[model samples]
Target chain A: MALHYSPVLWNRQKRLYDLTMAGLMALYLIIFCTLQTSLFPPITTETIVIRATSTLAFLMLHVILVIGPLCRLDNRFLPLLYNRRHLGVSMFIVAAVHSVFSVLQFHTRGDVDPLVSLFTSERQYGSFGQFPFQPLGFFALLILFVMAATSHDFWLKNLSPRVWKTLHMSVYLAYALIVMHVALGILQQETSPVYAGLMGVGVLTVSGLHVMAAFIGNRRELHPNAPATDGFVAVCDVNDIADNRAKTLMVNGQNIALFKYDGKLSAVSNLCRHQNGPLGEGKIIDGCITCPWHGYQYLPENGQSPPPFTEKIETYAVRCVGTTVWVNPQPYPPGTPQTPALLKVTTINDEN
Target chain B: MTPPLRRAHRFIWLLLVVALPLGFLATRPTKQSPWLQEPVLPPQSTAMPVLLRTIDADSLVLNLRQSVRGTERQLEILLKQPFETPSAVVCIRQEGSRRAVGLLNAPGLYRFPLPTGTNRPLVEIVDDVHGRTVKTVQL
Candidate 1:
């Protein structure tokens, strides 16, 4: 497929996004450096961690909002699209930190249960003027957790993608709740409007991007299918399939890839189970073929992930005849898998 | 994945979540200083005029603040003793040649640093807590 995507501008934009996140965090701390000693946290390790984690969480929400529509604006953004699960997971991590640190600072005393104490505090569940509970903030965090858990391909496979997408979209509602929570809970207590304004800006930016996606993205055209393969007929020259890297092949009425890496070469399903990202387009690292879109790595031999990760994909058989390679497209028994038959790479171009 | 590895991953995340807050609540501190160490004692002679708390006799230390005034000094010692005088000039010292180390404020804390040795007979302290007492001692 000779599709011209991955525009130079889009790559530049990605680099810019990465740098901007780093710069924003630096600026955030620099602005507060003078007040750190005077603040409630007052130069403690825990306080630093709390501030850092909260700042990171806010950054992630903005990234989520921006990246979605940006991909729609250009084809290159599609790669960013494929790995959004990892991004969501990363966001959950920071949010978890912020929540924990907050509970520790506010609710813990002697032997009291921290979770119980959060609700029990008079400052939380009070009257309207003092309506505590931090219900808005907590609600937001709970939604984040739900989204993170369901961000995996397993969930996409188990739960229909449409439902999964809708459920995960509740993050936007969670985002709104978080804004109110922060504004009322923290900014109100401090009598400062600066934080409130910043939060509003973050929410607006994200919401704006989604609105743009809705306008431009054609739901019917997304994920168009490819012409199915005929029989087990290999495409790429054997020489082009690098050691541990993948080269796309049309074989035995299916699109598969040949992977040679980590002292092993094998054939397997070409479509990324997560988002149908081309498995062949990804490179191999540390014995695992990492999806270039989101860096989800899989073992090439049997497509099993390293222990504890449990991600796996179907495998296929392959053979080499003189200068060319061949693959049998029938998928193998999954679950507990072994390397597909390996064919010795006999260099044809060496003599010619 | 085997059940154990799957469980390990699940538990690690749980620990991460739990440890984040629980850790913050669980960590506190303490206070110990060098000033509490006892200072060395001078030779044990009557000339030093030191009173003894009878509970501990073999091992001792002294750190007396030196600021004495008046030709007739008052010695208030929290120790076992024989009343040796009334309204008289006194020279108190180790059980030896006459020399005095008068006591202006004697009721001070005495810490028993170490257990007594059997080689020396025990020192005894006798005192009445609730009593109208007039202490006039000659050394």
Candidate 2:
């Protein structure tokens, strides 16, 4: 919800989020280092740093990945989704530290360049046991660098939400690479089953949550099977929608958000202009349909953000006939004003 | 998220559900334990014994042997005592270039096939944790 882009539009919530993240990261490092030093007396400082940061980054990545599906499954996790970029950036920094120390420790001693040695050190590509796992990690780090670098809204705006989202989706590839990196690298040396078991649980949890969320999302999609009358599809009764909230409907290949607010009904594109967040999941706050993901707002009548904000979404023609809300699936141009279909006072009373 | 992205997400996880477990199963270590085998010196080997000391002043007996079969030269090393430091490696340095022979995990006989036509090779036992050469021997 910014008019102009700066380095970071920090607010009280963002500041609190960052502070909490930093504190938790530091606490994790302290606990991990303490346990490592006490358990393994012969471990070096570099090894400890490498292990601690790598584990922290991996754990943070798991948390970051799960946050998305968790939000989709339950709105209670939306707060975590709001500040996820910070978590991603922090994870990248920690992962970069791990990559730096690993290269310094393992590859710097060689006569050839560190990067060259990292790729060419073990040329057992044909063999699964000796596959070059470090390169996978390096490429994963590269993807993370790109994601962390373009995490700001400025890039999101310039690149467009679709491209930005597609680029950020590479995090899944990075996660896969990291999984293989660990499976083929450290898991080979470490005899303990605990490490492998924990990794298995992480993979299962991430994949499982995503699958469940997708299933729930598919089930929740409102498909209008009722026949259309005069190009207007009867989506639901006016009282079916909660006040100030919306019910998303798919009519004539259009995803529409039918919002009921102030005894009136307005229909707009379900997709928010900002990051394509689900507008239907959001509620009208102060007469603006606020996006649930990042609080990007749009006026219910015209699908345009309030003054000073240029963002807009497509507005659909909606009308109420005998308490049944009918919406024209064809969308008007973004920011085009449409008269909201007024619900009967009796309908409002029935909702109450 | 858009419908396409949702489909892609589901597809990616579906693939991962199959691929990850397969990868984990495929990469499981299949090689035999090196420690289980008895330490046996190679036959027809010329042993060049050398005394090496660690930074902690512990003496180590390193028996380096070169067994030449036709044009191939193999370097065989037999350590009398176990290397106490974890992640230690035996490296061969020839003309300013160093190459790790193998991990020196336990005191035993180890064989590494050497590159042909090398002069004045130096063998060093390095502590990988500290990144220091603990002991060195010229051959």
Candidate 3:
């Protein structure tokens, strides 16, 4: 969205989002610390900070993991996805504080270095019940640190979207590591079943939402059952698509988004140039296809962003024979201008 | 997301759905280890001897004896066999403060002068190499 990279591209929404996030984090900390002190009078301040920050970080991670699926299930959650990088970075900072405090409390005051002591402190690698869990936490924190470091759009541009996305996908691995870190670490010592039950619920909710979202997304994908004639695949009727909206079609291994607007039909690759968002889910705003995930706009005819922007997507040759819209599965190069298929006046009048 | 990424996501979640609960259930404490369980304070009788065993399978045992000598109480660690862990050391924790007493690698008696006003001190055998407490006995 930015032509030049600044430290951050802050807008009114981003400012409000950050302020709300900070306020909620501060409030959670106050409530957690107050309750922890009242319930466990013998607990030390160091332990309280460690527990509070760790729990907060873990909760934030669950929220981050669910936002994508939530947004997929309902577009109303897109706002949460917009500023998610800030939440991720904040979670990493909290996790780092927890890690540092834990090391200082448990690993310091020893003859060996704190890092070395952390690994050597517990020699129960062979025992499942007594395995050393700190190293797992350390590795998970390392992954989060990498993700937080590369969260900027600058990295996204330099690394290319595919590489960047693949790197960020490792968040799932990090989440898995964190789950085991909690399961094998403090859960072993804590006698309360409430902690275990809460953890189990968190795991189930995160996984369940992802599975549901994937199922919905799969159902939305349209695959042509009939073979193509002369490289043109009959996708759907012109009336099947609403004005300014698109219907996604899969033909000849190509994912296409066929858009109907002003009695004209155009087909373009469903994959948005930015973040590979499903362009078919977006609407034509101001005569341009606006990506639902991020408002990255592209001209429907040329599959190119408007002036002052350089992003583009592959366009397909499309035509309407009597009201049945057919699209050539072979795609033109990105930004290739294609003639839109105009609907017949009688057909438009009949539908009206 | 691409089809491959979606497939990977589904596979990962499926694995987690099965693995997470299993891992958590496996972590449940079937029987509490002696070192992890609540410490039972021994009676303040000099005649009664307290015995502690290492957490590992080595079965290394140490007898703790408390005796009064010249108006001062002394705690002695009598090891029946040499410690299997060469870096093990005997430590005393009293009133939230811990101090190493002596090495337990030798199969002999080691004595440490117990400070006056020490109450219900916990005796521990720590493996310095691993930086873990291997045994604990409360007195």
Candidate 4:
């Protein structure tokens, strides 16, 4: 987070990510064109580039979508989440190349205006098999342009994280449009079942991954280790938690993670502010509870990230009696400093 | 980045690189290549007489008649639908030889040169969009 806007905050990791992405994009175009020319002679240059870029951008989008849920399911996929915006912008660039070349190839020399032709080329909207798909692609590209233009953190800060997230979610809408664009446009003319089968595989892969991730998250939320008590929920025994680790508890419909760190116990909201990452799954590093996804951290005592970064989460009151730990269902505001629950001297030996 | 995450990033790049060749192989075209097909004549019946009738909304008309210049034939094709640049080709095939005669976007009479000693030549028109056959006339 920054008070003032800069084009980008480039770090070593971001540089490497962008460079690799660009190189892969270039390599894809080169290889695609080479194979097209070699396998199918007489293919025009414009057609080759247009198809290559469209397929490349489509493939990149699928990868981007896969990374999100994959990262949520496993922390090992976190690096893809770091420079995801860069990949998004690159996809947009490739998509734009496809859109331009398509217009030039299909609409340019027609009697009507190019834009008009794009809309009116296939006038049979009444028939689903022959629907005018260029409009769908055009609108999807517009949404992608909006998303790419505002991918920077500057927009995230000004628009608020919630709004930015909501806006970005329109990517799913664009994805739907792209699916229809291909289904009604290219798939209509393409007789080979291979292309259709590939498209189906892509759709199913993305949908299946997201559904699996959501199911796993929901199962974790539905069942918690904490037993129901009067007002406070009895979490795991004080000895059950390892140093710098947490025992996740569900209290009053809220997931609260009770952390044991530096011989003290603290409870904070399990949900990370960014992307709703699971905080309980993360461990304390450098005195801060680091989120397994994207590495966003929050102080254990107060659910606030370190100074200069304004991200925060709700903190809960907790206490340890003998060897057992209990947490109050009530939660304090973000950044509220709740006193750390003291561990009993007798319970110290119980920690393994 | 953590070691595991860094490894994942590298894996994604590798997958992307590998996906290119794999995608091409998976989508290998199976349709008969136009180049590989024998230069066979289009469907034939009787030669069409000359006419100046208006073209249909969705069809381009090909008027084939004996050329005034010689025993050669001429084709007066009119495109009722919008087409790309004036690069459409009128292909004529007789026996084994196939000749592609270029035509402009504007309606005009094009010299339909056929192989010598050929009486009836099969004609096919290929447009810029998709290389689809816009019109075919057997003459």
Off by over 4 Å in 4: A222-230, A237-243, A247-250, A273-277, A322-324, A343-352, B1-139
Chain B TM-score list for all models: 0.23, 0.51, 0.49, 0.43
Q: In terms of TM-score, which candidate is strongest?
A: 3
Candidate 4 per-residue lDDT over residues A273-322, each given as its tens digit: 76556688789999999887657899999998999888888999887878
Give the residue spans of candidate 1 off by over 4 A. A1-41, A123-129, A218-352, B1-139
Model 1 scores a TM of 0.40
TM-score of chain A of 3: 0.94
Query: Which portions of model 2 show Cα errors greater than 4 Å?
Result: A345-352, B29-139
* Tens-digit lDDT track of model 1 for A187-218: 54443446546665665565555555444433
Per-residue lDDT tens digits of candidate 2, residues A263-291? 89999999888898999988999999999
- The TM-scores of all predictions, comma-separated, are 0.40, 0.78, 0.79, 0.71
| Order of the predicted models by TM-score, top scorer first | 3, 2, 4, 1
DockQ-better candidate, 3 vs 4: 3
Computed on alpha carbons, the lDDT of every model, listed in order, comes to 0.52, 0.83, 0.81, 0.73
Show model 3 residue runs off by greater than 4 Å: A345-352, B29-139
Which pairs in model 3 have colliding backbones?
A: none
Model 3 chain A scores worst on lDDT over the 10 consecutive residues at A343-352
Error of 4 at A84 (Å): 0.8
